[model samples]
Target: MSDTNVNPQITDAVTQANVKVVGDAPAIAMGNLYQAAAKSTGILFQNATGTQQQGALAEASTNQGVMQIYAMDTAADAATQVKVAETGVADNLTGLLTVLESFKDKGNP
Candidate 1:
């Protein structure tokens, strides 16, 4: 009978596959890490943008309130001026009536 021996081909193939996987592991891990970092940075920028918009809205609301107060103050001042002008007109009318009454009395006498 001839001696029989097992071929080492299958074992060699498995070893090469394992070596390839091990050699590529670092690159794969680094790629995954970079992806994660990009996602994190994107989230951070989105939050910052939201915060800025909120701040701008708050500022606009505050400015609107200030404008309303200014308008009210201006209206009050105008009302005061109108009241003063009406009082002056009433005083002038009264003085004119007194002078006309005196002139009529002197003419009748």
Candidate 2:
């Protein structure tokens, strides 16, 4: 038999301290959530940050903009695909309406 008196307040304080330690770095929680979601959905992502370069290449690269390149490239590619799809949709709808009108005229006669 033990005669140790346990303090509820002390135990609660210890538990809170452990939680605080675990919560100190938000990256730990974020990374765990990301991993869990990826496992459930079978998707993976990586952050792509690189070290700063020094020289003419870095200066030349800095003079231009990556955002502009990505935006223009994506817009150009998507616009061509959308334009072709829209033309096909328009032709299909016109043909269907013509067929429906002929059916209506035949039924009314």
Question: Quick one: best lDDT, which candidate?
Answer: 1
Clashes of 1: 0
Candidate 1 ranges with C-alpha deviation above 4 Å: 1-6, 74-109
Q: Give each model a TM-score.
A: 0.61, 0.23
Total residue pair clashes for candidate 2: 0
Please list all clashing residue pairs in model 2, or write none if there are none: none
Residues 1-109 of candidate 2 have per-residue lDDT tens digits of: 9999879999999999999888876978888999899886653222212223345568778667775676577777899999897789779899999988998899764
Taking the candidates one at a time, how many backbone clashes does each contain?
A: 0, 0
What is the lDDT, from 0 to 100, of the residue 15 in candidate 1? 93
Best by TM-score: 1
- Report the lDDT tens digits of candidate 1 across residue range 1-104: 89877579988899999999999999999999999999999999999999999999999999999998877878778999998987897798899999889988
Give the residue spans of candidate 2 off by over 4 A. Answer: 1-3, 28-109
Error of 1 at 30 (Å): 0.2
Superposition error at 61 for model 2 (Å): 26
